[model samples]
Target: MALFVQPWPIFLSINYLGLQACFLRVFMKIKLNNVCIFPLAQILNCVVYCIFVAMAAGLPFLNPYKSTDDADFRHGVNFAVAGSTALPTEILASENILSPVTNSSLSVQLGWMSTHFNSTCKTRGGWCVNQIKYLSFFLKQSTYCVEKLKNSLFMVGEIGGNDYNYALLPGKSIEEVKKIVPNVVEAIKNAVRRVIHYGAVRVIVPGNFPIGCFPIYLTRFQTNDTAVYDEDQCLKELNDFSKYHNDNLRRAIKDLKNEFPNVVIVLFTIILIFCFVMLYTGFDVMSLQKACCGIGGNYNFSLTRMCGAGLPVCSNPNQHISWDGVHLTQEAYKFMTGWLIRNMLHKLQCSV
Candidate 1:
């Protein structure tokens, strides 16, 4: 991600110099395969008036109700696509649950292809680009997105977990991997800052799900020590580690809010809401750690026999939360999205 606001001299020069600087930056950034930065100068020019007003008024003086009226707020959704969690899966998309923006009368002008985190990635056949490398690629693709950034609600991630997943996969002890948490948080913070700089007014930054409850973690870290397991049969240690990550992420977002007080950054704890949804529907929590689709194993997952086309799927995916060891089932995502919109629509200044 690009640092658009740091180091005053370069920032000012880029803006005053004009479009040549902007084009040059875009070309070089694309060449490096880091298509996340905008011409700081160009973006600066676009928001210069707002900045002046905000400064004069003592920071973040933009009113949410200023442009919004009864006819409604028009905004589209965009994912920072790290993998299947944000991707529109066939099961959900077919039911139209995945196309929230499309269903609401806003077209999905840009579609995200599935990509996995480099840490735990098993396959890479689809348009799955690395998030760390291509942060702003989708937003800059068209003028339509650029113009709508001010009103659009951006979902920054279900990210950062893959980084830890990557770390712990190679026989590294949890303690060793815990050190990587701050670095991961920093990367997320940078990405969030970049999106805000691009003119996104509202962003929901979700932290990692409780990995202790994940079948993949249980299968990989199984032990005879009963003390390590929780009442839900999930690993307590790993879940605590996940909490640590979420805490740090939340802190970073708090810091970002201090810097950009006008922007709305909601820290969504998906696991907390996830557990509540599971209990509310009276689903078997034991089945929570079991993959809905897979071949054979203690947790229905194996390095060799994972979820695939030929694998046996659960009688009803709606009854289970996890699809594979990592991703959630469509039913779960549907509920999560519903809960999110009902609760956050007001903050996004969105109605539909």
Candidate 2:
């Protein structure tokens, strides 16, 4: 899922310096239960960026999980589908919103995971009932599954972003979308619980990004009123909404930690890292609010003329942060993955 951008010689020094600093801080050999479980399963909503995260972690590219895939998950598998939401399609439909890209919501992804587990290993009762058939084989296989799950890291989301995206894109006010925050957070909480139930000892439930800083929202809600925009030139109200979501999500993670004292539940404060990247002096991002691959708007973004729709790409993508208005560029993901590894890798500690 790589986006090809011709390298610019002028920015080479800057990018190299940034990478050097990032590498010095991000030591990628951290282990979880004796396995380097950095090959994350379905992260946030970005399928392409998740690949970058895996790459940053120095793991092999994670193939999207298919129910038909053979029982070889040693390299891990990604169940994330782009544009999928935390809420069900029917639930969004009731709000007069639609998931234009996918019907594979969080629940659907969890179902895939359950199906994968079921196919991979039989229950204790089933093993007992069929002990006479293939006793040694089944016993070894079940033990393998248990150990695999116990060591594996499950990243639930930077999900529920699309729920608001869909609602807000079609003219839902910020207040109207705010009402769905609890439902969205609950859905994320339930996902964390489901993974825990399946033997996941380490889970990363990431909160939403600051939508106001994105080019998509910036373009869509452009205004002449200077008060609406923050010091970062992001929409103030939308960022506030993102904070509201993160605050609620943090409380939910705290509750999960209290409930499952034996499991490690990490709230990846992605928003903080994102803000740091934006505010960092050494990054050399020329336009923090404009899309590198979009056209014809204040933020160089248009709802109709999105990236990869034969739109004009920036000359130096490495110097830009936003990729296609909504998503971040590979450089941005690289920096972010580096920052995440440097900061939160220690926090992914297993419960003793």
| Each prediction's TM-score versus the true structure | 0.61, 0.83
lDDT of 1 by residue, 240-343 (tens): 98899899988999999999999988777777887776678656566777888775667887757777657777786667777776677655665665566446
| Residue lDDT tens for model 2, 8-52 | 000000000011111222334422121223332212113233444
Instruction: Evaluate all candidate structures by whole-model CA lDDT and list the values in order.
Output: 0.50, 0.66
Model 1 lDDT at residue 314: 75
The alpha-carbon lDDT assigned to residue 14 of candidate 2 equals 5
Error of 1 at 161 (Å): 1.2
lDDT, candidate 1, equals 0.50
Q: What lDDT does model 2 reach? A: 0.66
